[model samples]
Every structure is written in structure tokens, then in C-alpha cells.
Target: MTNGGWFNHYDDPDEFWDDEPLPIERTPLNPSPSPSPPQNPSSPPQKVVPTPKPVEPQPWTTGPVSKSAGAERLQSGVGSSFVAVQVDAGLLPVHVQLSPQWHRHVDGSEAGAELMRAYQKAIGIYLGETIKSGKYFSGEFRHPSAPPDRRTVLMLLLETASWADYRETQTRIYARNGFEVHGQAQIQNEPVTSMRANWFQVKSIRIWPDWARRADPIQIVDEVLCCANRVRELRPTFKIRGDYSRYSDEDLEYQHLQHRENLIEELGV
Candidate 1:
């Protein structure tokens, strides 16, 4: 409200700072002629602390991990490596590293689940017509690593499939459309104790990454489908190598027969 601020009476903040005296035309060499007050006996002398200069931060260095003196040694390419998921795409398994971003794309949403089911049914149809003879039935599976907390299935294409001999078990799993059924035929008066049906085994299963370490089969199937579709889109038939022509069933059986004959000749059995 006033023409000048209330602070006009005093010098600016700079004059009062750093023990600096008020502005004058000239600084006198002599001391002021003021009477000295009586010194208090209780006052103690204060020490002046020297200000320290600030230190600059050092630049970061990147090299091989430094090992402690007693650190256990690890072999080369061991302990420091990570495995990315690779689904078979023709010759090589297509690599797909699992990450937070990738996790969103294949979260087994409702749509994805339905699509996977359709693919599964189609694969089933292919296997149903391909495998016929009971002698070709095979039952062997590698134990999965990090078993999924929930049941998950992986639909695979069999390069060479054949039905194996029927075996009886209490497990009533072979009651599906793909499975051939008999109408309660009496075997030997053993009242329906065991169910006899054909078991099919594929000579080759589509390659997958180290599945023992896989935790989610659903994620695996999703990733595999992504890889397969991508490869198929790029190349109509993207196959690096095939074993069907190289090792036919006849050739394998002939080798087995020859090996058995050689063993019989040596052992006289």
C-alpha cells in the first residue's frame, strides 16, 4: 500500500551477510573508538571448522563378475546362463524368451483356450486315422519338470504313429471317441475286470525346449503355437530336417531283427 516497502530503511541482504560491514566511501585502517564491554569469564573459545570440497562420483565399470577368494568355481557357460523357451519349428526349435510383456500375449485367456481346444481336436483326428495296428502302441513320456499346478495338455503332431498292443489296466482313460470300443464281449468269464483296447505311440514327437524345467504347459503350448504359426506363415513348409525317410519303420525293424539274430548266434539261444 505504501510507495516504498518496509525494508527500504535497511541495506539489502548482501550487506548483512558474511560478516561484511555496511557500504562506505572508504574503509578505515584504524579500529572504531568504542568503549570495550567487560568480558564474561564463562564464555569459551570456539574452533573454526574448515569446509571440505565435494568429491565427484566415479564412473561405473563393467567386466566379468568378480569372484570372492573362497568362491566355488563354476564351469564355463554354467550357472550364469538362462534358458529361453524354444518350440519346434521345422528343423530348429524357435526361441521365445518368456518375459512380462510376452506373458500378457499368451495368458490363456478365454479366446486362446477355445482356439487351443480346436487345434487339439484337429490333432486328435489326425492321430485317429494315422495309428491303426495294435502292435505299434507305445506308452512312454518324459517326466515334466516343474509340474504345472493345474492340469495342462500339449497337443503334438506325430511324425510316425502306430497303435501298440492293448494292455488292461484299472485306469478307465481309453473311453474316448478316438479309441475303438468292444461291446462288453466276454473274454474268459472274468467279469469285465479289465478293459482291452489299442494304445498308440508316435515314433516321433515334435521337439520342444527342455520341458522338465517348464512350469506351465499352457504357456508352452501357447508359445509353441506362436512359433509354429510364425514359421509356417514365413515358409509354407519350414522343416530343417526329417527322419521319416532317413529311418523308415521297415529299416528299423530289419536292423532290430539282425541285431537279435547276431545275439542269438553269439549266445546260442
Candidate 2:
């Protein structure tokens, strides 16, 4: 039953009574501060890149060989050297010709004359058959510098061959010196045992370095065969090299008779 122009209030305590709107309070507009970088609780520690250290080469050791020293001498070849395998001992013998003093004398006091005699015979028979058979040279057959007495050294040189052949030849020569056979039937064997043994060794020597040496027994044989052919071509009939023809058949018969009479008297027959 109350009447008002623009305001009315009853039992409500928080009620607005105005004919116009109330003014809003002004708020200070400050630009929000730039957000700080986000902190990561689980971030890993930074890795450090290591710089490489320069390396120096180790120096050569002059110290003696020992477990404690932990050092070794650097070895090297000085010059040309010969390596010999001992057939009997099965050892490696290094024949280094570093000086003339190391060279052995063939005719020194230590040299055995009997051994030398056997050696010459072996060489002559072996070489002769090789020449006759036509084989290639093994590098071993070289004349080590000859001494003043040519007879003592008996240095014979053939063309160069493999080192192996040289070794085999030396072994054969020594072996022939002490050669012996049980049976006497071999005594009458043609060319003789000594000759056969020597010739066999010569052939064996040719086997080593056949490619490099180009050695063949057939070559030697061919030479001899060709030589014989040439000799036949020159003079078909066999004739003595010397003037043995000067002695007539009658003269030879007389000499034979005289030798027979002397042999009969010496034998008391």
C-alpha cells in the first residue's frame, strides 16, 4: 500500500535504490611483467667435451734384452750374406763374408791331402758326366778365390745356378769320399762305382732351380751326341787323335811279344 516515485525498499537489507546506475571504481592497469624462464626440476647436468692430447713417438732402445728392461735391439741386414743348412747337423749355418779373414784356406795345415784327392776325383767324374750329359749348371759350382797353389784349391767354376744345387754338390763330394759297397759284383760295373756315384750327384745338383737355372741333363747329352755327329761328319772312320798310326802293326806286335816275355819271367812261369 506504499507508493514511491523511483525507489522502493522493504525487508531486504542489501537492495539497491536508485533511479540512475552507480559509477565503477578505476583499477590500476600495470602491464604483466615478462614471465621468468621456466625452471626444470629434472634437468640433466651439462656434458664437457674433452680436447685430445698430442702423442709423441717412442725412441729406439739400446739396452740389452731382459724382461726387466722391457726393451729390444732393432736388428737389420748390413749386406749380402749366405744361409747354409747343415745336411748332417740340421742346423742353419750363416756364412757371412763380411771380411777376407773369414775366408777359409784350402791348403792350410788343417787341410787333409787324402780328403783333397778324393774331392778332386769326385769333382772330375761328376763334372765330366755333366758335360757329357748336357745338363744345366747349379749356382753352387763357383771358384771361391783361388790361392797361389792352383793344385791345392782346384777351384772349378761353372755358370751360376741355385744356392740349393751348390749345397747338394758339396754334400755329394763328402759322401763319395767315404763311399763303400758290400757286394764285389759292383766292382766290374761299367763306368765304376766312383764314377756312377759322382755322376748321380751331378744330376741331382741340376734338379734345384731348374726354372731359374734352365738346366737339363738332356742338354749335356745333346751336346755330346752333336759333337760325336760332327766328329763323324769330319772323319767318318774312327782314327786316333795323336800320331799312333806312325807305328805299323808289325812294330806293335813286336812290343807286345817283348812285354809278354818280361811278364812270364817276372811270374816264373
Name the weakest run of 10 consecutive residues (lDDT summed) in model 2.
83-92
lDDT of each: 0.31, 0.29
- Alpha-carbon RMSD of each model: 26.2, 35.9
What TM-score do all the candidates reach, one by one? 0.16, 0.15
**Candidate 1 lDDT, tens digit per residue, 1-269?**
53332333267733323344456687688969899787788998658999998863321111122221112121111210122433221222244344433333433232223323333333333332222211113322221121221111110012212111111110122222222222121335422111121222111112222331333544544444443443333332212133444655556566545644554466555
Clashes per candidate, residues 3 or more apart or on different chains:
8, 11
Best by lDDT: 1
Model 2 ranges with Cα > 4 A deviation: 1-245
Model 1 deviation from the true structure expressed as Cα RMSD, one decimal place: 26.2
